[model samples]
Target: MYSYDVKVLPKNTSLWGGVGIEKAISSNSLLICRNDELGVSLKLFTKNQDDGAVPFGTLAPGETYIFRLNEVTLIGAKTTDDVSDSMVRCTIVCPQSN
Candidate 1:
């Protein structure tokens, strides 16, 4: 996962999954995880609309929202979640720094 500066702590709460910003320099499949002071489990929408669409507050075009390393899905060139909802169409980024 890309190292993005964050301001919020990982609180134990349900996640409302959504797609990624397509016009971003970097894009990846984003998964919302839930941890209620117990083990961690990813939260997904019951319907198909939320399957990949990023939340409304995520990486909006021209707007950058800081996010934590929720998780990484693909690795090779750079590193990203392999998200399909991203607006930009580019190759996958594999993690190389660490």
Candidate 2:
């Protein structure tokens, strides 16, 4: 298990201004949630942060989402407001290998 406080900054002209998490192990699932006390909406990207495609999903403050981690190579996060930075909390859990 691992926990991360991902910082998401405002998007700029050249970059999306976010953080990415690459798969490190054969994880069975992922638990992602926005900080309940503060911050704005968060947009999630399945591909690289620089990808031109739209975000796969969005999570509002105090919201939580769960899914398989193996299907994603990278997970990117960015603030939707584009004015302030957001701190998103992510928790990853992997089953022990046999």
Candidate 3:
């Protein structure tokens, strides 16, 4: 039997009202969608700044989107529904060996 410890890097965060997460993710990091509702719009961009933002599509309630971002630097999200100020919760995970 082989046993190993997996370390989860960084803390989970949430974005609301078209705001960006305070912490930027390094390229090829893992992004896990925790909770999303009210038609949240997701955007991902590179660290180059001038690269602009890339639309990563939207997610609904009880739905999850998980992916290993490609050269992703920052991530921003907001609600696309008729109502004002929506919230989306996401967990950023980077696997590290013990």
Candidate of highest lDDT: 2
Residue 89 lDDT (model 3):
49
TM-score of 3: 0.49
Off by over 4 Å in 2: 12-27, 48-54, 96-98
TM-score of 1: 0.18
User: Can you give the TM-score per candidate against the true fold?
Assistant: 0.18, 0.66, 0.49
For residues 1-98, write the lDDT of model 3, one tens digit per residue.
11222111122222311234334444545666543354344332223234555566655554766656454445545444434343444565666768
**Per-model C-alpha RMSD:** 14.9, 5.2, 9.4
Model 2 error, position 24 (Å): 8.6
Candidate 3 wrongly placed segments (more than 4 Å): 1-28, 37-50, 96-98
Q: What's the lDDT for residue 68 in model 3?
A: 67
Q: Give a tens-digit lDDT track for model 1, residues 1-98.
A: 32222112222111222233222223334432212222222222221222333333223222222233234221111112332222211222244455
Clashing pairs in 3: none
